[model samples]
Target: MLTRHFLALLFLLAFAPPGTCGPVKILMLGTSLTQGYGLPPGVEIPALLQAKLKAAGVDSKVINAGVSGDTSTDAASRLDWSLADHPDAAIVEVGSNDALRGIPPAETERSISTILAKLEAQHVPTLLLGMKAPRNLGSAYVRSFDAIYPRLAKRYGTMLYPFLLEGVVLNPKLNQADGMHPNPAGAKIIAEHIFPYAKALVRKARVRRTAK
Candidate 1:
C-alpha cells in the first residue's frame, strides 16, 4: 500500500497539469507528412506525438494542420488562418511541394522566412523541418533549396529537424504507393524520432508558464 501510494504521488508530480491553460497546445503545420498521408486517423505524426507526450508524463495537445501538396507559398498565404488557434508552438514543414513543382529555391526561402518571421513576432515557439530538393532539380537548386531551413532556423533561433522524414522517406517499405508519403509504420518511425524534441519544447513551455 505504501509503495502504491508513493508511485501514485510520483505520477501526479510528473504529469501534473501546467498552470492556467492546463495543457500545452502544439500546432503541426506541414504537408501530407503531418496529415499522416497514407495512414489512418490517429496514426499520423501529430496523433503519435500527442500519445508519446502523454506516455512521457507531459500534458499536451497537438493540432494537425497539414494539407496535401502545400508549398511554402501556400502556407504563407494561409498563415494567418492557421494561427487562429493561437498555439503554444508550431512545427513548420513546407518546401517539399516547392521543390516538386520546380519553384525557385529563392522564392521558397522567402516565403518560409516570412512565415517564420510572423510567428516569431508573436513569440510562438517553432520547429522547422527541412526537406531535400529533388535530385533532378540539379546541384545548384539543391544547394540553394536545402540550405533554407538551417539558415532560417539560425536567423529565427528555431529548432530544426533537418529532414522531417529522415528515417522513412527513402525506405521503400516505409512509404505509401505513390512514393511520396509515409505509411503507418513509417509514420511511427517519424513520431519516434521527433517525439523527444517536441516533448522537451512543451515541457519548457510549461516551465515558462509556471515561472510567470
Candidate 2:
C-alpha cells in the first residue's frame, strides 16, 4: 500500500504544473479592474494572471499599476512613473473610466493613443484591453468609444484584446454588490480569457531584454 501510494503521488506531481522559471515582469496598468476593487489579495486580476502564467510554466511577475478611478487622461499623465518597473511587456486597461465619466471619444482616443505611443517608444510589447460604452450612452457614443480600441490598435500596431470584461460584466453572480467590478470568481474567468494573449506577451518578453 505504501509503495502504491508513493507511485500515485509521483504521478500527481509529474503533472502538477511547475512554478515560474524566474520573474518576467509584466505591468498591468488600469483602474479598479486591475486594482482588484472587490477581490481579495491573491484573487486579484494581476495575481490571478500571474498564477495562470505560472501554471503554464511561465515566469510572469505581474505588477499591479492600477489606480482606481483613473481615466485615460490620468493614466497618460502618470505613464512615466508607472513604467518605473521597466516591464518586459504591458497590458493596458485604461479608457473605461473615461467612458464612464462621459469623456468625449476623441479625448479618450488621444490619451490612449499617446499612452500606446509611449510604450512603443520604450520598445515594450503591449496588449490593449478594450471596453465598450454602455448602450444607454446612445448609439453615437457607442460607435465612437467602441471604435476607439480597434482604431488605436491599428495606429500603434499593438495586440488588442477586444473586451476586457468579456464574460463577467452584467452577470450579477460574477460581479460584486455594486455590480461594476468583478468578484473573485469573476476575476479568475477574466484571467483565463486573457491568458492566451498575456502568454504571447510572456513569450515576447522572454526573447527581448528588459525595457530601458
Candidate 3:
C-alpha cells in the first residue's frame, strides 16, 4: 500500500499543471515610457500589467526592469542581469531615446537585435513594443528607425506590438507636461492595449512550463 501511494504522489507531482508551482515571472524591459516616468509608484506599465494579470485569474508576476532615459543600447547592456531572475517571458519597450538622440538606425537595430537574441537563447517568450521616430527627424530618418522593430521581431520570431504609445502619443490630454511620457490615465490606456499580448505571453509560458 505504501509503495503504491508513493508512486501515485510522484505521478501527481510530475503532471502538475503550469502555474501550480508558482506565479509566472514576466520581465518588462524598457525605457522611461516603461518606467512610468513622473508617475507615482504602482502606476507604471509593469504595475498596471500585474493588476490585469491578477484580475484575469492568471498567476503571474511582472518585473519592472524599466530605466528612465534608457536607449536600446542601455537596455542591451543590462539584459543579462535582468535575465538573472529567470523570467518565463519578457516585454521589450526601449528605443524612443535612441530615436530622440538621432542615433543611427542601424546602431539601434543592432542593440535591439542583441537583446532579442539573448532572450531567444534562454527560450523565453518575448513581446516587442515598437517605437516610431519623431516626425521632425525627416522622412528618411523616420523610415529607417521605424523599420527596425518589425524587422528584428520577424528575425527573432518574437511577438510584436506595433507602436508602443499607439493612441496615447500626440494627444495633449494623454501626455505629461513635458509632452512626453503618459500620464496616469494615458498609462491605463497603454495597459489595456498591451494586456492582450501580455496575456498571450503568459499562456505561452504556461504551455512551455507544462511541456517541460
Of the candidates shown, which would achieve the greatest lDDT relative to the real structure?
3
lDDT of 1 at 188: 91
Tens digit per residue, CA lDDT, model 1, 90-192: 8898999999999999999999999999999878888888899878889999999999999999999999889887878778899888888888888899889
lDDT for each residue of candidate 2 in 86-124, tens digit (9 for 90 to 100):
787899999888888899999999999999999999888
Candidate of highest TM-score = 3
* Model 3 Cα lDDT, one tens digit per residue, 36-71: 899999999999999999999988999999999998
**Least well predicted 10-residue stretch by lDDT in candidate 1:** 14-23
Sort the candidates on TM-score, descending order.
3, 1, 2
Query: What TM-score, computed on C-alpha atoms, does each candidate reach?
Result: 0.88, 0.87, 0.92
lDDT of each: 0.86, 0.89, 0.93
* Residue 22 error, candidate 2, Å: 4.5
By the TM-score metric, which is better: model 1 or model 3? 3
Error of 1 at 1 (Å): 23
Error of 1 at 61 (Å): 0.6
Candidate 2 achieves a global lDDT of: 0.89
TM-score of 2: 0.87
Ranking by lDDT: 3, 2, 1
Worst ten-residue run, lDDT, model 2? 13-22
Q: Stretches of candidate 3 above 4 Å error?
A: 1-11, 14-20
